[model samples]
Target chain A: MWRIAIYETVYIIIYGLYTVFEFICGMFEYVYQTVFFTCHEFLFPSEKRARLKELVSKIKKKPKHLTVLLGPEDAEVTDLANLVIWCLASQIVFISFYDHKGSLKKKEEKLQLEVKKHSGDTAQVIWYTDENSNLENGFKGSKVHVKIITDEDSKMSAATITKLLVESENEDFTIENIHKHFVKQFRFPDPEMGILFGKDYCFYNYPPWQMRLTEFFRFKSAKSITYAQFLNLLVKFSQREQRLGK
Target chain B: MSWVVDNQLTRFQKFCVNVIKCGPIPRHIAIIMDGNRRYAIRNKMGKTEGHTKGFERLAECLLWCRELGVKEVTVYAFSIENFNRTIEEVDTLMSLAKEKFERVFEEKDKIMMEGIKIRVIGNLSLVPEDIRILLAKSVLLTKDNDKSILNIAFSYTARDEIVHSMKTVVEGLESKKIKPADVDADLISYCMYSNQSPDPDILIRTSGEVRLSDFLLWQISQHTQICFTSVLWPDFSIWHLLGCIFKYQRAFPGLKKYADECQSNRKKLNDRITSFLGDIEKKRMEQMEIYAKT
Candidate 1:
């Protein structure tokens, strides 16, 4: 009888402990979800989203062309696709991605497909891996036009521009004329701002001509870019006063 | 405890020094000496007093550059826009330039002994005549020294330099000394303010400003790596300068390759232009000979 009584007491204690453990786990899960939701919501603030939408909707001027430099890190193609989708949602008409090395062929193809699937014929996405590509072809309509610039593009641009300037100046060349012709021929627009998503805040030669008056914004890493980060960057860029090399 | 921490920091700095030495060093450096007025305002000091402190800092920076094996240093001393400031400020700056140039002239022997070549690159005609004379004398004194170059851009603006080059090119075209076909980037570069100095490899601007500020705009477009810092000019230290060099080292290989490619491209075009000019000269000489015989 005594042995039976001891077993009953131990069984009660074990059951009580099990109940406490389950309660603790439940509390932890609830806290975890609350923290995650808060962080997620912080990036998607209603006020900031409203400000960005309002600023972009003004139609007061053409949407500013922004170029983003990807660093040496192996950022996923899905992240790039997400960035494009967010940019479209935010009403940024033109976006450019410049990498120092040439774009990965398979990855670029996949990215193009993904972008096409997302935006359909509404967006013109061109992967410019070399100088021979038709650089002056697009930027019509109200669609978002995305251009992927590789190192080869910058090299070719420099070489071709220099050759054209040198050859034409012999005929009738002034700096002003060279610039006008180059702009018209290359269809190059001076980027209003360049966002460098690299570990180190450095320009990896993002086509020197396009960056003459560009205000550069640097971020630590672009591996997992969120929509809130993109809109926040645009908000910050709107507030920056460009002296234009006074 | 503080002494121990200092020792560890010193050891780390030495490690950085060793790492930097293993890489290629920048041969030429350009500095936009900015933020003197801001520094003065922050410190509640007079503007001229801030400038005086800046000069002292420059002297120390020169020694640091020399130690780092930098062959040339260019300082953007005064921009043309500076004249638009209050007359009191302008007069103070001009007097300061005169004093500094006079000192450099007075120490001509020491400058020559160190093989330091000092050149003033700007539209010097705008400067007061006495200061211009002193600048000319200083340049003449240090013309032969080849050890190091100190280019002081006084009364200078990049746009003015480009315009001057264009005018010179036009004059050449009119004189028929050079044909229109021969005008290229190389020829234009040769006509700029710092023609004697190679393009700067590293450009450092203080006071956290990131723009080029119209300083060396054309020359630096090729492959120059820029470093911007928040430290005021007066507080710029050797460590900051070394940190900049380390950043340059990181960028050196890629930039050097690009610069080399550009050089080769220019060389090819220059050669073609040269051969064309030579052929033209040959034809003219043959025509002259025929005319003589006739």
Candidate 2:
């Protein structure tokens, strides 16, 4: 018992010294990084973005077919766009959905600028919510190949969704028909997968067809919320190992 | 004719409508309502005054939620950690809760008496004797209220809930009331503070923070979460509440999960309703035609 007491005393002293060292290291680490991500990044009293960053970098090495959903007003989107272009330029598939309205001339011009900025060398698909276009309640349908959902106003159909649903089902309900319908709504001729961004998870049902038990991550911000953070989100989601049949 | 498809859809607007239409809307919604001090200081006020204003806001929000079909609303009124605050402010908060609860008991107002049941969740072991007794009486009198439930997580926590359940479950096992095989997540959950309330369908927080802060930690899962940063708790209005619900609808879209793509294999739920409505419309039209022909 006395030996145990001495062991505990030595253990406490060593841990105490280790704790002090960690505190000093933590202060220096935080001091180095001033400009972090958005308000949600700092919401946690404990700033632990480093663990998230480490995970994101791990995913980047394996480099699966990745998509980055873009928000129009956020600085984080710009930071991400730049990160992909500068670092893992070939690894990522940067996608965006912005307002493709106004004069046919002005809309096209705006799309050109946005595509150039956000898409880098990656492919771009601008949102089309026009009359002749196929959409089920603004977004969703058989025609869409890629589903890029973000919290942008011009991208969602709002309350007119009921009408969009009515239109999507103008024909008889069939599996092949529904598949065709979704393809038309997304407007992406060959969109293989869908990606939801972490910036604004206020999903107004974009790509309403595809998001059946899809994995999601409320990611850390862009600047300081490193590539490893994104990688970690993917890793955590991959490990969940759920069967969708239920 | 007003269906102008030329205009574009914004992300926030679409997100709002989709989530509300999804699953069963929560009849009783609970919240932590944290960051009033941070919010108040951001608006330039003393820390102590923030809680005072948040209290008044809480009173008004109860009426608003009741009117909006929220049967019950629970909030973390005070926590065990809150006892660590300055003695003067903690005393002031205790007195305020006692005074408010007393009025709720005495007031014959329909809003106070009708169906709205109020309960407090926490360890009462540490509360003052008078305050604890008053709480008990308030819970007793409000037991018959059927309209809604308002649960306050004062000094409540998930860890305590787990410990409390463990003790009870252990006793049951020792007494041979429940077998070991019956031990599961559901059994432990049934013994939780939120077992009386349906799992919160939607959890909303204000002042823009996203962490759960140990509030309803066990009860919330896959529930639509909405955190509005710009709105403070006191100024949290009906309009904003509508916005939150609408946003909740947009988040969950309930569309695809129902789609199944195999329409024939799946039960036609909506088409059945639409067909029913169509038959009613048809019968009415036929009767009107018969009348017109006559």
Candidate 3:
């Protein structure tokens, strides 16, 4: 019993010290990133677009489908629109935005307007919802498809698809069939890259069926996301070698 | 003097561990133990030797997690994709797995005392018969213990697990045992191999991998904290475990809030689906009954 008491005392004292240490480290990182990002932005204001374009050109392998996990703190529609325009510029055909609260999904029109404003006549933006919709065939030249995903799209789709397969009498309900259904339903290929804009690296329930081989990266803050950071992430994605369980 | 210093160093380490225990600890932790082969190459050892060292590290990690009050742990022991490896390596891994399960028998009394329940979550049909028997025996032996759970994801992939769950649901529906209304996210989750425990609170991947690599994609929610470390599996230490736990503690509050919100949202979706599919459920039951009669 006395041994337990001594251990508890030591634990309390050490825990206090540990928290203090962690706080100091966190503050230092925050300050460093703030200064560095601000200086980088100020120092290279005019060359930002060209540099981003150059970085994009340098990426040999670009992800066809990219999913962004937006945290509550980073759910700004304007920032999301900027990301969409960036994806268009980089020739990424499919981009999906996910926030747990479904706040972006509610304001889909405003987001589309924002994207239109930024993308102008350079790109055709198609908002994809499901496979059977006529919008699925609307893809043509210079087309970008944007999906606003929420928690409902993950498990709910699984249940609904399972129900459909179970009810279909003539069709063979196999894994491959399910995969085809999902591809048609979601109208997007499996995400090759996923970026999380949050303080931590949680997916927040991004579609489980789609992220089997997705390489995920994290951005510190969505509010201060820069072109360089996005370029760096693309470079990182290009450099990664996916073994796919081999 | 060296021995004395070592003793004191270990004592301090113990003290540090105790301090960490004062914070919020993850109830369940999952790990993607990567870079065993890399460790082997780096150390100029055979691949088998690296895997052996990785297994030793796993044993050490389990002990540390138990000490820290983590109730459940799931590890990516082997993947279905690993079947593509060289025949010699595959045979070695199978033998190694067989040997480990045999040791489980030798340590039965200790395992029982520790109250660790052994569970192998994956497609068991893929394994050889002998290793499968040993795995089944270990699971049966430790079935009653409840103090902690060790889930070995052998011959597993997240896609395979999801498919397995969907197959179960589909089979149930075909047999008229389950209704269409009953198939929801929670139900699908319950059908998963790792459904015995809650979703992991923290998933740590060693060797600097930022990908889930087909591990627990459905089970991990938006709130599951992920920690990617550059340490190889064989080189992973208790300090690394402690560091992961500390990070989990710092993020616990935000994670809990997000988890709660997700739970409510899931419930709402389930309820909506149930109501919407009520008529379809009746029609499906009738169809199944007729099919059964024919």
Share of reference contacts found in each model: 0.03, 0.01, 0.74
- As a whole number from 0 to 100, the lDDT of residue B136 in candidate 2 is 64
Candidate number achieving the greatest lDDT relative to the actual structure: 3
TM-score of chain A of each: 0.66, 0.43, 0.83
Docking class of 2: incorrect
Candidate structures ordered by lDDT, highest first? 3, 1, 2
Of 2 and 3, the candidate ranking higher by lDDT? 3
Which digits, one per residue and each the tens of the lDDT, describe model 2 over residues A1-246? 675555456545644675688678767655654434434357652555665545555542322333333321243334544434422433333233321111222343343454457544433333343334232454332111122333222112211221333434343333344345444554443222223344344332233233323334454234455544445555554454322111
- List residue ranges in candidate 2 displaced over 4 A: A1-246, B1-24, B39-48, B108-112, B224-230, B253-294
The list of candidate 3 runs beyond 4 A from truth reads A1-54, A129-141, A170-174, B1-9, B264-294
Task: Provide chain B TM-scores across all predictions.
Answer: 0.85, 0.73, 0.87
How many clashes (backbone N, Cα, C below 3 Å) per candidate? 0, 50, 1
**lDDT of the candidates, in the order given:** 0.67, 0.49, 0.80
DockQ-based CAPRI category assigned to the predicted complex of candidate 3: medium
Question: Compared with the true structure, what per-residue lDDT tens digits does model 1 show for residues B1-294?
Answer: 000011223555544444455558788999998878789999999999999888878876776666557989999998876777778888999888878877885666667677888777887767777777777777766767898888999888765676555555555565566676566656666656676678889889898765665577667756777787889999887789877886676566667776786677664446644554454445433543443233
State in Å the error of residue B91, model 3: 1.2
Residues A138-184, candidate 3, lDDT per residue (tens digit)?
Answer: 55557788997766678778887778776675255455777887786
